[model samples]
Each structure stands twice: as C-alpha cells, then as structure tokens.
Target: MSAAAAATARDALRAATDAIHARLHGLPALQALAEGRIGRAGYVALLRRLLGFHAAVEAALADAPSLGPSLIPWGIDIAQRRRAGLIEADLATLGAALGASAGPVPLAPLPALGTVPRALGCLYVTEGSTLGGRQLARALDGLLPPGEAGRRFLLGHGARHGAMWRACCAALEHCGAEPARRAEMLAAAEATFLAFEAWFAGAP
Candidate 1:
C-alpha cells in the first residue's frame, strides 16, 4: 500500500477503535434506559443499536484499502454467521448475563434489536484484525519457507484474536447478560478491542 493509503487505513482503524470505546462508555447509560436490568425488550433495543454501530464500522473498514483480503472475507463471514444463528452459544452466554434463563434467543425473534445499531461496529473491528493478521502470517510463511520468525508472527497474531475473544467472553460472564443487551455486551466488546490493541502494540 502507498504510504498515504496506509496512513489513511491506520486512521480509519483508530476511528473505529474510538467509536467502539465511545459505545462502551455509553453502555451503562443505555442499560439504565433499559430499566437498569436487561429483559427481552431491553435486549432487543440494545441489539438494534449494536447492529447499527457494527454496520457503520464495517463501512469504514470497506473504505480502508490497506486491509488484507482475508480481513474482508473474515468480517463478512462472521456477520453472516451471526445472522445465521452461529453465535447462539455466545449469545446465550450474554443472555444469561442479563438474567435470561432461556437459551439462545433467535435474532429473528428480536424485532426491537433489529431496529437499532450498536455492537456490529466493534465486531467488525475485531474481525478485521483477525483476518489481517492471518493474511500477513500466511504471506510471511510463504515467503520465508517456515522460519521461527514467521511462526512467531502467526502465533502472535492468532494470540491477539484469542485474547480479544476471551475478553469478550469474560465480559459476558461478568455481567451475566443476554446477547441482545447492549450495555453488558458493549462493555465486553470494549474489553475485546482493548485486548486486541494491547496485543497489537506488543507484537514484533
């Protein structure tokens, strides 16, 4: 990528990161608006907001040319999976955090959540890093013929994703909330992003 293009990509990434942080800060307030405890209605509203935010973040990623090809596909795949109910387990964990005793709530069943946009942006950001890292590792491995440095790079990149994913999981466990509940999910999402940021900064 051209230096200008790379700079633009970095800026876009930072903006997405900032946006995710902003949403994280806003979660408690949104949760309060949901009656201080998340229920079906509250969860629905939160999901809508998250979805909208995700869409915007995805758009920003689309504008970033520095991202590797794997990044885009990985992002699209995750979004599709979520839409296709693949995130049921994670969603259920979130539901439990929100005091939901029921199992995975279908996205189709939650109209309120569909009406707003929120966590989708952060989701995309995580996926972008994951995909980009994977692509970089693959390229390096191909070029270097499987040296320790290449292996280390791949491992580091994968670790970043793992840390972020774990952070998300931890956040869910922290709140005992449902997937559709924006406040808790956003907090968890923020944890995920921060973990990724830390990992990125520490990488060689």
Candidate 2:
C-alpha cells in the first residue's frame, strides 16, 4: 500500500472509534480519576475494575499467536506490553498499605477474537490506552504513597511509552492495509469499546 492509502486506513480507524473513545472519557469513575477527584476507596475500586479489563484483554491477546507476524517487525513485543501484572501489583500494594488483601478482581468480558485483525483490534484499544495512562499517572501523584508502589499500571511503559505506541500504530496501519482486514479490525475495535463502556458502567 502507498503512504496515502496507509494514512487513510489509520484515519478511518480513528474516525470510527472517536465517538466511543470520547464516551469512555466521560465515564464517571474514569473522569473523576483523571481529574484527581477520586478518594482512596474510589481509586482502589477503579484499579480493581481496570485490572479486570486489562487482565482479560491481555490474556486473550497472548493466546493469539498469529498477531506476532504483523507486530514483531514493528518492535511491538506482546510480552513486554503486558500490563495486567502491573495492575495486580498495584492492587496488592494498595491492599497491603491498608493491611488487607486486594481480594479477587473479576475479569471484564470482551468480544471474541476470532481473526488476526479482530485480535489486533483488541490490542489497539489496550495498547493505545497507555498514552492516556501517562497523564493519569501524573494525575495520581499525590494519591499513592511515596514511590511508584500503587501507580505502576498508570505509569505504564514509562519512557518507552511513546515508542511502543508509535510501533503499535504502525502495525495497525499495516494490518489495516487490506480493506477486508481493516473492516474486521474496525468492527472489533468498536465492539471492544462498547464492551468496555458497558462493563465500566456497571453492566455485567
């Protein structure tokens, strides 16, 4: 595909998911957390939910090996991108800080990843989330105790965040080069966003 064609598919993805992406920002818990208005309990609850979401999504992506070809050449290492563990650790720290267990975090239900593009679509949502995580990490400065104990998930890949995101975007463009694959990716992306919104909204 030419540069112009690649740009168009990338734009198509952004255009398709833009509305739902905006809606995710409007989620009360997420909005409050982003604005630094959430208290300890609320913060913990938010992390618990996020842990569920990331844990499920990342696990599904891990099980899909076909994504390796499109991703590896772009420097996108799936293992390096796993964030559920960070979230789990953060929860443990928060729980320990309170002299209690974080308990079990339920996994958020996600759309089926039946194809490579569908799997990529799911990855797109989770990986792209790290960009916002950087800002959210800053918003959490005074919330967690000193050091990076409970905010590791938000801190994400730290300095590597930008590079990882760029690589992921490039991989996405490559996968979207084929129109059929692009449609599958877009549909799955939309489904992922909707599922996320529903889960975060307290729906089962």
Candidate 3:
C-alpha cells in the first residue's frame, strides 16, 4: 500500500476497535493481571492456559484461508512468532522456582468466529495483546518479592511492540474498511476477547 492509503487504513482500524480494546481492558481477567491479584502458581496456571489457547488459535488461522493470506505481508503468523514457547518457558521457570509442578491446562474452545474477515478480526485482537503484555509484565514485577524469572511472553517484543501493532492496524485498515467487513472484524475481535476472558477464568 502507498503511504497515504496505509495511513488511512491504519486510522480506520484504530477507530474501529477503540471501544472493543477498551472493553477488553476492563475485563476481570485483565484487571486481575494489572492488580497483581495472582501469584507464582497463578501465573503459571495462566501461562499453561494461554499456551493451549494459542495452539488452538494457530490451528484456526491455518484453517482459515483469509487470515493467513491477509497477514502474510506483515508476517503475522502466530506460530512463527513462537509466543507459545515463550509462555511455556515462563511456566517452567516459574513453576520450578516454586517447586510446583505444571500440568496440562485445559484448552478453551475457540469461538466459531465464522468467515475469513472474522478470523482476521481474531488475529487483530491476539496481535494487539502484546501491548497489554507490557503492562502485565509491570504488574507481575509488583507481585512482591519480585524476580526476573517468567517474562518471555509478557516481555513481549519489548521495543518492537509498537511497530508490530502498527503493522496490524495497517493490515486491518486495508482489509476491513468496508462496512460489512468492518462489522465482521469487530464481531470476531469481540468474540476473541470473550473467549480469552473465559479461558483465563479457569486460571488460579
């Protein structure tokens, strides 16, 4: 896309999900993370659950034709990102430190998000999570008796988070600018947030 077109698309994507991102930020699961309501084992539980959920999300993306092709230019493939591995590393380090065993966390069923546009919406939500991961890392740091252990995923892309998110917004703007497409994408992103909230509900 040309510079002007990319800018327009980015703006549209940003405007479209402003409310949805706000709602997700207000969720109990995210609130708990921000408040540091969970401890070492709680964090480990979260990691396991998120890892499983991510695996399922990857499967859906692979199965969904639109999502993969849409994000390929921006390299949004979640599998290649190795986010799940980062989560597992955190779990192992955190669990081993606490002398707690990490077990298989039950997977949450992905929302049936429907269609290619909707799946791209789902990708938007997931990719956008890295921004929040920075906050989560800060909250975890405040967990009293803090250590540098367990920060692979939540550490996110560090200095690169902004660039990644911008790329996603650009893609969204390009693909979801139409009224029908925007609606489908927004619905999928909302569903993804709900699915994530439910998945984290079981974390303890």
TM-score of each: 0.27, 0.86, 0.73
Worst 10 residues of 3 by lDDT: 1-10
User: What is the per-residue lDDT of model 1 for residues 1-204, given as tens digits with 9 covering 90 to 100?
Assistant: 431232332333344356554543344424343233444444444434433333434444344444324333223233332221212222343342223564432221111111111233345344443444344335433234454332232233343456655443343233323334434334434545654334323322
The residue pairs in collision within model 2 are: none
The TM-score of predicted model 3 comes to 0.73
Q: Which candidate is the best by TM-score?
A: 2
Candidate-wise lDDT, in order: 0.36, 0.79, 0.66
- Model 3 C-alpha lDDT per residue in residues 1-204, reported as the tens digit of each score: 332233454444455556656766666656677888877656665666678788777766677666566567644554555476677777667654223364554567787654656766787777777877877787876663464468778876667678777766766776666767766776677778778766666555
Compared with the true structure, the alpha-carbon lDDT of candidate 3 equals: 0.66
Candidate 3 clashing pairs? none
Q: Looking at candidate 3, what is the lDDT of residue 165?
A: 73
After superposing all C-alphas onto the true structure, candidate 1 shows an RMSD in angstroms of 17.9
Q: Rank the candidates by lDDT, best first.
A: 2, 3, 1
lDDT (Cα) of model 1: 0.36
